[model samples]
Structures are given as structure tokens and as C-alpha cells.
Target: MTQRADVVVVGGGQSGLAAGYHLRRLGVDFVVLDAQSAPGGAWQHTWDSLRLFSPAAHSSLPGRLMPAQQGETYPDAGHVVDYLSDYEKRYELPVQHGAQAQAVRRDGGRFRVETEAGDWSARAVVSATGTWSRPFLPAVPGQDVFTGRRLHTVAYRRPADFAGQRVVVVGGGNSGAQIAADLALAGDVTVTWATQRPPRFLPDDIDGRTLFDVATARRRALDAGRSDTGGVASLGDIVAVPPVRAARDAGLLHAKPMFTRLTATGVQWADGSRSDADAIIWCTGFRPALAHLAPLGLRGPRGHIPTAGTRAVAEPRLHLLGYGDWTGPASATLIGVGRPARDAARDIAQQLSS
Candidate 1:
């Protein structure tokens, strides 16, 4: 028999856990399904040397302080995982690790979730799976023909691995810049940052506060209708670290034109320039992975699950927490989704009670 719960939270990260906590507090029975064996989502897969730009004071889940003392430089990726593990233990949240949700469909008034573990039926569902489900690697022609090592930024850990090699760091995001700089120091790195827009960088801190605070303020402004809410492409408001600028100043980094295609030995740029490299690291970013529910007509033109203001457009019983542009202060962060979780949980509880 399929297990039944009042609500099923699909994901065991902070957002899902927060949703589960709220459900339990409201006397709503729920279960959390996570694909990973641990609570941290993408953090568990992050580069080993990665650390948060935001300090510990701002890098916290709702109702729980970050273990690091206030003003401490943001925790490393490992520290994040440890903190998340502690959070899960402290809450005693009903999370089933290694439960990969394959499909979600509405059955009558309830939603049926099919996963690797088993089937679960719930009156409401929380799709807390963040937006980075699928890495958005650019599809370049002859990409497979490349004769060098190619890896996505998600899999890249340390630059020491690429020592003494000519590296081509593609993409112009923060990850691209940081990785390219690190590699340049380690070896003869030629970072071909393919981007149409001019790059902008931010300081590590502004007035003793992190740039994440600025982002949070911008989010609040967008929500308060006092500012223009732009898409992810408009990252001017987002702070880029100073190290990126220093890398450029050190003559180790240079911007390359947009990508045209991949050749057997290297990459070709739109400006008719080509460069050979020992390896390529694609930091193109990621997209939502809802392929399991291809039948669900809930995706936007951009392939993101079209959310009707956080609630799923096609399935009201189904809700999403971190799948949009203005994900509030914590949209993609562990701290950002807490407020959204409370809002979603309240809506789900009201829907169930009524």
C-alpha cells in the first residue's frame, strides 16, 4: 500500500525541512523526500574549496542561528553541510534521504509522488527542489570531439588539479571568474570568458557588511514596489568579489567574445578567434530538472516550472519554493526560502483544513 501523508515535501534541504517543520507544528503529517543521502542539496556537491560570500550572520536558516560566531567569514562548503546536518538532527524533521522523486501527479484531490523508494500520496506537495537541478551547459557543435578534458564547474573542485596546464574557463559568472583566477595562479591559464555583457564586480564587503545584505535589500525593494525587478541577466545589483577585479588587474584574466562552437582541439569565438587549451570548465549555470513530469503542463517558456506566485500554475495542491527570479533574500540560499516555506505551508494547511 502507498504511504499517505497530509503533505509531502520533495527535497530535504532547508526549504523542504522548513516546510516540514511548519507542517509538523501545525499538526499536519508530512514526509520529506531527498535524492541525496544528506540534507544539504547542491551544497553537498559543491567544490570542496567553496565558501560563502555572505558572512555567518546572514547565512542562517529561519529560527536557527548559523553555528559560526557572528561576523565570521562565511562558512566553507563543508561547514555548510555540517550545519545542515545539525539542523536536520535538531529538528528531527521527517526526511527520507536517498528518496529520489521521479514523478508527481494529482490523483483526485490528492497528489501522488512516485520515487525510487516507494509511492506517497499527500493532500499537498512542496517542490522545494531548487532551480539548479540541471547544469545549463551550452550545447556547442563538435563539443564531443574536443580532445581535452572537459568538466562543468559543478564538478570542478581545486585548481591544483589543473596545475601546469593551459585552462580555458568558459562562461562569465562568478564561478567562472573565480575558477579562472585560481587556475591562472596555478598554471598557464587562459580564461576565455564568453559573455556579451560587460562584467561587473562587487567588493567582498561593504561598510563591514556582506554584499548579500545588498542583495537582500534589493529583494526587499523589489517586493516593496520601490524598484524595478529585473531578470537574472541584470546582475549589476549583485556584488562580484574584489578578487575577480584583482585577477583582471594582474593581467591573468581577459574577456572573450561569445561562444560560436567547439572544435576538435579548442573553442571558436564569435569574433573569429580560436584558442587551444588543455581543459575547459563550463560554468554556464543550471536549470530546473522536471523532466520526470514531462506530462505536467506547468513549465514556463524558459522551462522553469511556471509558478503562480509560488503555487504551481497547473496544480494548486503542488507548490514550489525556489524556482523563480526574485526568490526573496533566500531564494537560492538556505536562509532565503524560509519565509516562502512559511507562506506556502500556511496556504497548504488552509487548503487541507478547508
Candidate 2:
């Protein structure tokens, strides 16, 4: 059966749920389609010990209060997943799970979204699959020749998985640092971390509040068009840097400048350094999942969809969320994704009513 609506929201993450909640409240007819069987996109697939650097107070979704926790410490991945599941139930939002939209095509004045289940038509679409859907692993020369076990950050759940093995973590981001530290300490594994950029570190607390709290405040100031305090960096960057320094200080991991190539038995560094390892963990990053969105002609460069002023890209009746400060990090975060969601629904509603 073919379903029709004013909008069809792709992806069932925080952004998508926010869009659905706002759309329903506005009396708009719409349906949300999700690739995952459950909500919480990347959170469901993240490393087991992952936690948000943003505190609970600043992290709640729209129309719902964040659950009270004991300390100001960050919430874990499972805690976030639980919150998202609860948010959906509270809103009683309609979502079609496991209905992955494989391709989207334009049909006259309407958009046809083809999923594994069937085809649905909508006047507008919100692509919220997010950037993490596609893990971007660079083609290291001779990667295929490596005989050791290789895993991306997506597949790594716990450091225990690499017990008693030498692990080479290839990436500069927090994920790589954290994983290396965890494995080195818990399992006594030898770990090495490589990156092209040197990480900048920050203290964990400032003026009685946690570093996470200060970061959020800075972001909010930036979003409101107020001048920044000038001493701080982005929350994402700050969060990534400290853990890496901690891991280094603990002798849990060694930081290498960058990776040069992969050999049959190990990896070589640009500084002519080499290491023997039993495993390699790639924590490079991800690209937006838009291979299914080829018909829209929205891709700009590096296979990323280009947005026209944050609401829509080159295509009409299409909106993108979590596209890095479209509404700022407050809306970009797992907890604070509602700001853009509300904006998206409002803009989409206006377009439809016109």
C-alpha cells in the first residue's frame, strides 16, 4: 500500500524525533522512516563506554525533561538510548521502523521515497540520517596486504576485545584515544595512536562547573550571536583533547604523528617509524549517507550534501539536520537536537501551507 503525507522524515535519530514531535504538534500529516529497528542512530552502534560530554541539564530534548542523574558526569551510550526510546513513547509519535529508504526520486510535483517495504509519497522530506551513517576509512596503501585483525571505531565495543594484543589505533579523535587507553589499562595491551593533527587539551573543570558545562555555555553564547569568551574552543574538540592527554600521561598509549602505509605485518609512519601490532583500529570519521539520494543532485564536494542556508540544499521540499552548526552545536548534539528540528518543522510547515 502506498502511504501519503505532507512530509517523510528519514532517519530515526534525535533530530528526526524532534522533527516528528514538532510536526505532529503543528497538525501536519507526516510519517517518520528509520533504517534502524530502534531509535538512537549512532548511539546504538558506538563504543560500549561512550558518553556525552554535555551535562544532563543542557542535553534534554524538546518537551521533555532530562532524567535526573547523580552527578554532573556525562551520560553513557545506553542512558542516551533509553532517553530517546522514552521520548518517542512520550510523544506517541508514529515511526516506521526497519523501513530504510533505499532511493528517493522526484515524480512531477511530489517526491517518491522507495523503501524496502514499499513506496511512499510526500510533499517534503527531511534527511536526518546524520554524518555518522557512513564511516570514512581512507585507503591506506597496502591495506589489503595486512595480515592482522582490523576494526573500525564502529565495530569496537569494549577494550577487553583486544586483550593481550598489540593494538594500533589509527586516528586523532577522542574515540581513538579512549579506545587505546582502555585497552592498554584494562587488558595491558600495547597501544599506539596516530593522527595528522596534534590535539589541544583543556582542564576538566573551571569555576566550580565541569568543562562540559562551560563548553555548552560557550556554544549557547555563540548561537545567540554574542561574542565568545575567547579562551575556549568548541566542545567537541575540547572533549576529544583531554582524554587523549590523559591516556598519554598514563602511559596507556603513545601518540604518533601520522600513518604512512600498511605493511603485510604492521604499519609504517611518515617519520619513518614502524610498529608491530596484532590489531588496527580506524577511528577516522564518517560521511553523510546520501548514496540513496542521488536523484536530488545535492552533493557538493567530498560526497557531502550541500545545504542552502541550513534549511534546504539544492532541492526543494528537502531539509537537512545536524549538518554542523546549521543551528549550532546545541542542536547538533544527541541531547540538544531539538532546536533545528523545531526550525525544520516550522519552515516545512510554511512551505506546505503556501
Candidate 3:
């Protein structure tokens, strides 16, 4: 069956919902397609101990502010899941769960979205699929031959699952630090945290709100064509969240130079030093989830679809939301996605009317 709308949103996560909020306000005919069977998007897939970088009140969607959880400053993943699940209903966004978008193509000067459920034709398409689905793992010498278990960030669940094992957690990002700390503090595992470069921890007081402000400043300066101070990258990598801070204070989060190669049972360093391990966790990160947009063939050398603001540069009818700085400053965040979403909706409204 072919359904039709003014705009077809290809993701039903925070970014998609934000677009829905604005589109609804404009009284545009739109529908949100979510691959997941339920709401919460990628938040439902996070590790058990994971928590937000800021309080609920500061982390929110456009139409509604996320309510604070009692007895928790930075709420856990479960809280975020509950919030997102409730958000769609509270706003009455027209979202179809289990509607995995397979591809997007141009048809009749419009866009047709082929999905698991059926097909949707729209004057404009919003590809808001975020990055959680495509976890990245770098190649290393002997990585293929390693007998022990190797897993990426997406596969990691709870530290308790690795109990009593010697684990080598690789990558210098927030995931690596948090997972290593989680293992050291909670799991009965010996963790050797490794990174290409030393991980930088932000000041304890710095959180998502401050990061958003810095991104805003950077965007403003760049728009004005002025010399810009680097945004979030300038501050540091890790935000000393409670778990990471606790582990660091306890001297359990020391990071060593990354191993040069993976051995049969563990990893070997460049200095001929080695650590035996039962498993290796790759906390590297992810690429944006945009495979469904591959049919459009607009991705550039940087593996991103070029865009002016949120609208696709080559195809004005196609808009990319969430995805991160490439699409819009801080747009991948729950709170930061609103402006771009609103702008995208307004642009679609104008295009449809024109």
C-alpha cells in the first residue's frame, strides 16, 4: 500500500519527534517512521549503567521539557526510554513503529520511501536516523586471529556480564572510560583501559548544557565568518560523570597507550609489553545510520550527505536531521535537535505550498 503525506520522516527518534512537533504546529500532513517496535529509539539499546550527561530538566524536546526523576540528578537510560516513550503519545505524533525504511528514491519529482511495512510518498523527506546502529571497530594486527571474545560498544550490556575476566577495553571516548570504570567498580573483572591518545576529562561541573552553549557560540561565529574557538572538541573528551569520577578518584580509570596488536588470548603493546585478557571491548563509536539514503547517492568523501542547514544541497526536497554537526550544530542531542527540526519543517511547509 502506498501512503502519502506532505513530509515523510524516516526516523522516529528525538530528532524525528522534534520535526513532528513543528510540523504539527504548522498543520502539515506528515508521518514518522521508526524501525524499532516501540518508542525510545537508541536509548533502549544502551548499557544498563549508562546515564545522561545532564539533568532531565535541561535535556528535553522542543514542545515539552523532560521531567526530572526523583533521587537522580542525571537519569539512567531507563528514564530516558520512559521519557521518549511518553513523549510521542503526549504530543500525538503520527509515528509508525516497526517501519524500517529500506531505501529512499526520487519519484515524480517527489520522494518514495520503501520500508518494511509499505511505501510512503512525500513532497519532502526527513532522514533523522541517528548513529547508534553502526558501531565502528578499527582493524588491528592479529585482530582476526584473536581467540578471545571481541565486541563493540553496541554489543556491550552490563559490566557484570564480564565478571571474573581480564578485559581490555579500547578507545579513549566516553564509552571506553565509562565501561572500564563500570567493570572495575561493579564487575569482578580486571580491566586494562587502552587509548590511542590519553583521554581528556572535562571539568566536573561541565555537562550537556554547557556543551550546547559552546556549540551555539561556535555556530554563531562560523555563520558570522569570524575566527571561532573550537566547540565541544576544545573542552575535552570525557565529561566526568558520577561513575567515571568515582572510578577515577578510586584510581581505577588509568588509561594506557593502545596495544599494537591482538594476540591469541589478549593484546600486545609496542614496547613488547602484553596483557592477558578473556575479552576485548571496542568502544570506538559509530557512523551516522543513513544506509536507507544510499539510493540517493549524495554522500561525500567524509561519508556524510552535504546539506545547507538541514536541507540536502543537491535535493532540496530531502532534508537530513539529527546526524550531528554536519546537519546542524548539536543537532544529534535531544535538546539541540529542536531548532533544526523546526527549520526543516518550516522549509518543507514553504516548499509544499510553493
Candidate 4:
């Protein structure tokens, strides 16, 4: 027997939870299917030392503000997990854990969501499956032959495990910078930072809050027919967090250009210079985890489904929430995901009512 709901939100992460919050307010019949055994979404998989760039107040989802311990500025991953767990409990969102959605296909006027647990027929489907499950690694020459340990940021845990080894951290984003700093601080390892381009750093005062504000302003300006000056710092630019700042102070934040190829023992530079390394940590970002939506055949180039304000352009019955800015500006962040989720829920409700 096929279960039915007004909407099926695939992924019970922060994005799906936010959507559930709005849907619950509208009294809509919706179910959030989560892959994990418990709450917290992707936060449970992050490295132990990870911390939000924004303070607790700035990094909150809609409705409830994330509570921080006294004197705690930026909340760690565990804090986020706890907050998410509590938020779901407080709202009593209809989320079914361990129900991993495998595929989604249109069935008559509704959508059929096939999951590990069962099949759900929904009027609309909101894919809040964020990028945590799809860590990306750029292909370089001789990558298959590399003998050393290579890992993406998704699998990274603690720095102690990598102590006393030559480590090369790749990617110019915040993760790379932070992980490099962590490695440098944890042990007497030789840390080599590699980036495709020189890493751009936001000023000491700028954090995720400032970046969101800047993004919002830029979006407004563009919408208002004004030319954006592009002066605001990019969200991808590394922020000088306390640890990153310490790394900079200690002259360990220097970055080298990306290596030309991977050598058996390490990596080779464009100049053919080679250096031995025990491990390579790839902090490259992620692609949207949209495999469940593959049955719909909506994915465009690079696995991204074209969207307009969280609604799929080709498939109006499908709404992709919290994937990234394509769905909504700043939608991938903890605080930023709520807007799109709310909009998605409202749209889904409207569709169902109609």
C-alpha cells in the first residue's frame, strides 16, 4: 500500500525541518524522511573541532534562535546538533528517521517518493538533501596512482589522528583553511596548503552574519535594477576565525598554487617540483545530493536542477530547498535555509489548496 501526504520533504536536516515548521503552521499534511538514525542532520558527520563562522544568534533557523552557552560566541557542531534535535522535538515535526528516500517520480498529478521504509505519494516534494553527502574531489593527473592517504573534508574527524605526518590540505575555502590550521596546531606535521588561486580572506570583523547581510543587499540591488559594485566579500572567502588567526600569526596560513599532478609519494607542482606527503586532505566543496530526484530527469549540467526560488523550473511539483544559492541566496547555511524552506512550504500549501 502507498502512503499519501500533501507533501513529502526528503531529508530531515535543518532545511527539511524548517520546511516542516512552516508546513505545520499551515496545517499541511507533510512528512520529512531522514536518512540518519537520529536528529542533527549532517552536523553529526562534521569534524569535532568545527565551529560556525557566525555567532549562535546569527546562525539560527527560523522560529527558534540557537541557544549558546554563556560566553560561547560561535557554536560548535555538537551545539548545532543539540539545537536541531530540540527544535524538532519542540515543533513535533512529522519526521521519520532512517527512511532514506531512494527515488522520486511523478505519478499522475502527484509525486511518488520511494524510500527504504515505504513509498509516499505526495502532491509536492521538497528536496532539502543538502551537499554533505556528496563531497567533491577534483580530478588531477596520476590521482589513481597516489599511494598516500587521500580524503575529503566529509570523512575528516580529528587532527590527532594525522599528527606527526606531512599533510597537504587542498581547496581555498574556509574548510581547507580551518583544517590546515587544525593540523598545524595539533602536531609537529609539515602542512602544505594548496589552492587553485590565492585564498581571499575576509576582514577580522566579518563573519557569516556580515556575509549574509551583504548577499541580501546585493540581491536586493540586483532586483531593484541597480548595478552591484561587487565590493562585498565573497561568502567563499576564508574568515579569520580564532584558530585561523592564530595560524596567520604563526605564519602558517600561506598557500601554494595547486599541484599539477599527484605523485606516488606526494604531489608535483607545475614547475615539476615534488614534495613528499603522508596525506592529502581535500576540502573541496560539494555537489547537490539530488540523486533521489534523478527519476524525474530534471538535473541539468553538473547535477544541479534549475530552480526559481526553490521551485524546480521544469517540475513545478518539485521544490529543491537548502541546496545552495541557486535555490535561494544563502540557502545552504543554517540561518539562511529558513527563507527558502518557508517559501517552499507556502507554495506547496497553495498548490495543495488549489
Candidate 5:
């Protein structure tokens, strides 16, 4: 079946919802397509203990502030999921669940979006699918032959699953630190946290909101031809959330340089020393989910779609939200997505009206 709208959003997560809210307020007709069967987007796939980097209020979409969890300052994955689900219903966004977008292409004057559920032709398209579906694992020698259990952060559910196992956790980002701490606190898993560089923990109070502000300020200064003031990245890599702080204070977390290579039953370090690990967990990051836009041929040599703000440089009718800083100052975050979404909607409205 073919459905038509003024716009079509390719995700139903926080980004997609934000785009929907703005598009609706602008009096644009749109439908959001989600691959997942339910609400919450990737939050539904997050581990049981995963917590937001900020409090609920600081991590909310536009039109509605996320309600606080009574006893927890940093809300858990379930709390985020609940908020997203509620936000969708509260705004009455037109999101079609279980509609996985397969490909998108220019169909004459309109964009045709093909999905598992059906087809949509829209005057404008919003690609809001974030990076969760495309987990990135760096290529390491001998990793292909490692006999032990190998896992990526995407599939990880809980620390209890790794209890009593000798594990090597790789990656220097927030995920690696959090997962390492979770396993250590389980009291049974033997962990060796590995990183490309020494992990730098941000101040206890420096959370997502603060980082977003600093990053934004730095970006604007640079764009205005002023000297780079500095971004949150210059301060640290890790957010030092509650669990990581507790684990660090308790001396349960320590970092080792990443292993040179993986052995059949362990990893070998640069010093030629080896640590026997029963499992290897790659807490590496993710790439932007842009496979659906492949047919558009918009991605450049750097694997990114060139954009003027959120709108594609080549295809002005397409706007990409929530990919990262390049789309907007901090468009990937729930709170930060609001401004970019509004701008994208406004631009679309103007473009269509003209």
C-alpha cells in the first residue's frame, strides 16, 4: 500500500518523536516509522542497569519534561523507556510501529520511503534513526580466531551474565567503564579494563547537560572565526556517573592499555605478557544508522551525509536528526534535539510552502 504525507520520519525514538512534535506544531502532516514493535527505541534494548548520564528532567524531549524517578537521581533504562513511551502518547505522534525502513529514494518530485510495513511518499523526509543499530567493533589481529565468548555492548544485558567469568573489556568510553564497574560489583567476575588511552573521568557534577553547553559554546566560537575556547571533550572522556565513581573509589576499576592481540584463550599485551580471559567484551561505540539512505547517494568520502545544518546538502528535502553534533550542536541527546528539530521543521515548512 502507498501512503502519502507532507513528511515521513524514519525513526520512532527520541529524535523521531521530537521531529514529529515540531512537524505537528508547524501543521505538517507526517508519519513516523519504527522498526521496533514497541516504544522506547534503543532504550528497550539497553542493559537492565544502564542509567542516563543526567537526571530525568535534563534528559527530556520537547513539549514534555521527563518525570523524575522517586529515589534515583540518574534514571535507569526502564525509566527512559517509560518516559519515551509516555511522550509519544502524550503528543499523539503518528508513529507506525514495526515498520522497518529498508530504503529511501527520490521518486520524481517526492521521496519514496520503503519499509517492511508499507510505502510512503513524502514531500520531505526526516532521517532520525540514531546509531544504536550499527555497533562498531574495531578490527584487531587474531580476534577472528579467539575461541572464547565474544560480545558487543549492543547485546549485553546485565552483569550477572558474566559472573564468575574471566573477562577483558575493551574501549575507553562511557560504556566500557560502566560495564567494567557493573561486572566488578557483581563480586564474581574477574575484569581487566582495557583502553586506547588512560581513561579521564569528568568531575562528579559534570553531566550531559553541562557537556552539551560547553560543546555548544565551543562550536559557536569556532564557527564565528574565534579561537577555540574548549569543549567538554577537553575536560574528560568519562562522565564519572555514580556507579563508576563508587567503583573507582573502592579501587575496583583500573585501566590497562589495549591488548596487542587476542590469543585463543587470552590476550597478549605490548610487554609480551598475557592475561587469560574467558570472554572478551567489546564496549566499542556505534556508527550512524544510514543504510536506509544508501539509495540517495548522499554520503561523502567520510561516510557522512554533507548537511547544511540538519538538511542534506545535496538533497535539501531530507533532514537528518540525532546523528550527532554535526547535525546540530547536540542533536543526539533528548534535550538537545529540540532546537534542531524545530529548525528542521521550519526549514521544511518554508521549502514546501515556496
Candidate 6:
């Protein structure tokens, strides 16, 4: 027999947890299906040195604050993982670990959530399955023939393994800058930062918290049907973290335009300049992890399912959360995801109650 709930939250990451929090408050019967064996979600898999761009107070969920760390402005990955585990226990949210949702299909007016453990029949389904599982790598000419070690940001753990090598870090995002800085600081590797366009750096005073506020203003402006006049920073711009700022002072933040193609030994620039590299790190970002939702026939171009806010446009009973800004303004961030999760929970509660 299939288990039943009024709402089934797929992916017990920050977004899923947030959704569960609001649903519990609304007295909605729900269960969170998490693929991992323990708490922390994707934070458990990130690099050892990875730190949030915002302080603990600003990077929190709906009901609780992420406890601040001593002598640390931004908490590290392990700190976040510990906090998430504690948060789940503190709230006593019903989250089933190691229950990977394989497929979600419409069953008459309800939805069937098929997982490795068992099937769950839910009145509504909220997919908070984030993008960590799906790391994207862009195709460059002769990439297949390149013999050097290549890795995506998801697989990267630390810089110790990259010592005494020529490494090319690709992409203009925060991950790219941080990784490149890591390699440069390793003291034995030659690092080259490459991007399709020059990277935009946020002012030294700007951080993720400020970026979130900027995003909120933009969102409010859009909702009010007015152009955003706030000269807020773009979230994509690189934050001047301590390590990154130090690297800049050491003259390691210089970046070159993206190469035209990959050679067997390294990369070739548009001007025919060749840089020999022992490894390449691609920080090209990710696509939404929506493969399980394929059975619903909701995926459109670019691996995105069209949505009215977080609700699926074609299937009103389904909601996609925490993938990116497309679902909600800054929905992929810890501070930004709560708004959408709360709204989604409210909608699901209303639908089930009605």
C-alpha cells in the first residue's frame, strides 16, 4: 500500500526544509523525501573551504537562525551542515532520508511520488530537488582529445591535490574565482583565470546579504510594474572575500578571455596563443535537477518547467522550488528560498483544505 500525505516535498535541502516548516505551521500533513543518508543536503558535498558570502544572521530559514560561529563572519560548509542537521531535529520535521524520489506522476487529481523506499500519494508535490546533482560542462572543440585531468566545481574538494601543476580555471562566477584563488595560493601551481567575458566584481563592502536585498528590491519593482532604479549589485558579480582580495593584492586575479578551443595539452586562445595546462577546472554552473519530473511531461526547453511563480503552469498541483531565480527571485539562495517555500506551502495548504 502506498503511503499518503496532503503534501510531499521532494528533496530535503534548504528549500525543502523551508517548505516543510511552513506546511507544518499551516497544519498541512506532509513528508520530506531526501536522497542523502543524513542531514545537510548539498552543503555536505561542497568543498571544504567553501564559505557563504553572507553572515549567519542573514543566511537563515523561516523559523530558526543559523547559529553564528566564533571569530568567523561567514560560516564554513561543515558549520552549515551541522546547523541544518540540528534545525531538522529542532523542528522535528518528518523527513525520510535515503528516500530518493524516482518519478512523479499524476494519479487522477492527486500525485504519486515513486521513491526507492515506497510510493507516496500526495495531494500536492513540491520539488525542491536542487542543481547540485547536475553539474554542467560546456563543450569546447577537441575537448575529447585533451589528456589533462578535468573536473567540475561539484567534484572539486580541495587544492592540495593540485599542487605542482598548471591549472586553468574556467568561468567567471564565484566558484571560478574562488577555485582559481585556491590553486594560486597552493604555492606550487600556475593558475590562469579564463572567462567568456571579464568578470564583474562587487565592491569590497558588498556581500551575499546585500545582494539578496538588491534582488528583493528588483523583485518588488517588477511586481509593482515599475523599472528598478535601485543601483543594487548583481548576484553574479564576484564578492571580494578575504581569500579573493588577498589573491588580488598578490596579482593573481588577472583573467584572460575564454580560449577558442581545447588542445590535447591545454587551451588555445583566439590569437593563437597556447597555454599548456595539466588540468582544467570548469565552474560553468548547473541546470535544474528535473529528470525525475520528466514523466510529468512538464520539462520545457533548457531543462526548465514553465511555472506561474513556483506552481507548474500545466499542472497546478506541482511546484518547483530552489532551482534558481526562474522559480522565484533568488530562490536558489538560503535567504532567498524561504519566501517561495512559504508561498508554495500556503498555496498547497489552501488547495488541500479547499
User: How many backbone clashes can be found in candidate 6?
Assistant: 0
Ranked candidates, highest lDDT first: 5, 3, 6, 4, 2, 1
Q: Residues 1-354, candidate 4, lDDT per residue (tens digit)?
A: 899998899999999999999999999998999999999999999998888989999999899999884667888899999999999999999999999999998899889999999999998899999999988988889999999999999988988888789999999889999999988887587899999999988888888888887777776777689997463454448988888988988998899999999999999999989999999999999988988988898888777898878999999889999887778878889888888788888888888888
Q: Which sections of candidate 6 miss by over 4 Å?
A: 228-236
Give the number of colliding residue pairs in candidate 3. Answer: 0
Off by over 4 Å in 5: none
TM-score of each prediction? 0.88, 0.88, 0.99, 0.97, 0.98, 0.97
RMSD of 6: 1.4
Residues 1-354 of candidate 5 have per-residue lDDT tens digits of 799998999999999999999989999989999999999999999887899998999999988999999899999999999999998999899999999999998999999999998899999999999999999988999987789999899988887888788999998899999999998888899999999999999988899989889878987887899998768778899999998999999999999998999988899999999999999999999999999999999998657899989999999999999998889988888888999999999999999899
lDDT of 2 by residue, 75-112 (tens): 77788888889988888888888999998889889999
TM-score of candidate 2 on Cα atoms, chains taken together: 0.88
On the 0 to 100 scale, the lDDT of residue 247 in model 2 is 64
What lDDT does each candidate get?
0.72, 0.75, 0.92, 0.89, 0.92, 0.90
User: By lDDT, is 3 or 4 better?
Assistant: 3
Candidate 6 C-alpha lDDT tens digits along 197-254 = 9888888888988888787788888778998645344444689887888888899889
Candidate 3 per-residue lDDT, tens place, 182-244, comes to 999974789999999999999999999999999989998998999878999999999899999
Per-residue CA lDDT of model 1 for 212-262, tens digit only, reads 445566666777788654433344522444445557778877767666877
- Superposed by TM-score, candidate 1 places the C-alpha of residue 310 at a distance from the truth, in angstroms, of 1.5
Better of 4 and 5 by lDDT: 5
Using lDDT as the measure, name the better of candidate 1 and candidate 2: 2
Clashing pairs in 6: none
